[model samples]
Target: MLEIKELRAGYGEAEILKGISLTVKPGEIHGIMGPNGHGKSTMSKILIGHPAYTVTGGGVTFNGKNLLEMPPEKRALEGMFLAYQYPVEIPGVNNAEFLRMAYNEKRKHEKLEPVDPLDFDELLNAKMKFLNMDSRFKERAVNEGFSGGEKKKNEILQMALLEPKVAILDEIDSGLDIDALKVVAEGVNKLAGPGNSLLIITHYPRILQYIKPHHVHVLIRGNIVRSGGMDLAEELETTGYDSYLKGK
Candidate 1:
């Protein structure tokens, strides 16, 4: 569902992603594990057109559409979902209203009518319950006072609602407890099926144990250096990332 070739992206005058080439097939969950500053997060940001990073070379095509050329909002409308490590908070807007507007906005782009409050509540509530989240969170302000774990759950809630073809999760396990992680991971697992792909950018192997990726790639110095199975993650946990550097 997503194909990236020789992608070079970075901040002004300083490249982070020297060149990244990866592909995510539909219904496959791919894991990207790397040491800090290896450009894993940079690749994720560039995929969605973050203004902070500029794509200097190569191409990104999602579901046969040009990604680098499209605007960020257009990327969202095109079924690319990103779950941020730190979700932003907008105090004035209530959570339900935020989700309502988002669901409708995407539909509007697809030439569909927005659902009414009663229908929105029914549809969104089912997903919230599926995630085992409290119903009261809908009435709260958007991340205004939510805890770190709650923000992550809210992100999963959005993912469940939006149903993107390619979902890129950046450091999703950060600050989450075992229970919260299970809930979040379970929600992702449920959402993983035909016509959907996940590219998870994470550090620890704990989340990988839950998600069970089909392919795992290790990134070193802004490049994908090693590709392996789930066993590679276990190996990394026991041996660390240094031995794999250079010719060992």
Candidate 2:
């Protein structure tokens, strides 16, 4: 439910995303595979309205609305979620408190009443159990003392709670072990339904092995050079991005 066309964006004067275009239909899981130094993460940030990058050209539409015109908070409220590559820690805020605030904010945008703390606890606990996360984590500071896996799991928990229409996960698999990776992937797989979509931006195909994206794209030097099915990921696993970059 998101369409991007020839989006050129960058920090300051140096352009990173040059003519990037992709469309994610409802309920489709699209994987973006690329090497470092490219504009993979930059594109994700731009989509979510991160102020660090400026959109110099082109456009993005989410669910038929002009995404480029919305602010960052408006983007999230409009059903766009970005799971960061490096989840930051907020020491003073309890994980549950932070989540509840975010969850209620989205609900408010939907013209719904705020969820009571008691009801929110029950809802949060259910998601925690489903994600196989310990309930004790709810009482801790947000990502303050969590392990790398725990931090990623927390991100998924946020996704499950928010239930955005289009979720863009940038390197969610980084720093995760095999078991942690499976748990995170499984949580993501469970979140996929008829009403939402996922854009998984990752370099390695290992996470794709579990998530099994419906489409895979190879991005090199700020441009999507090739697009294919899961086989493209497997091929990249064997051939690397070098072959794809040769003629680009």
lDDT against the true structure, per candidate, is 0.90, 0.93
Error of 1 at 156 (Å): 0.3
**Residue 136 of model 2, lDDT score:** 89
After superposing candidate 1, which stretches have Cα over 4 Å from the reference?
245-248
**lDDT tens digits by residue: candidate 2, 27-112:** 89999999998999999989988888999999999989999999899999999999888889999999999999999999899899
Model 1 / residue 240 / CA error / Å: 1.7
Q: 186-210, model 1: which lDDT tens digit per residue? A: 9999999978999889888889999
Clashing pairs in 1: none
Worst 10 residues of 2 by lDDT: 239-248
Q: Best-fitting candidate, measured by lDDT?
A: 2
Q: Judging by TM-score against the true structure, name the best candidate.
A: 2
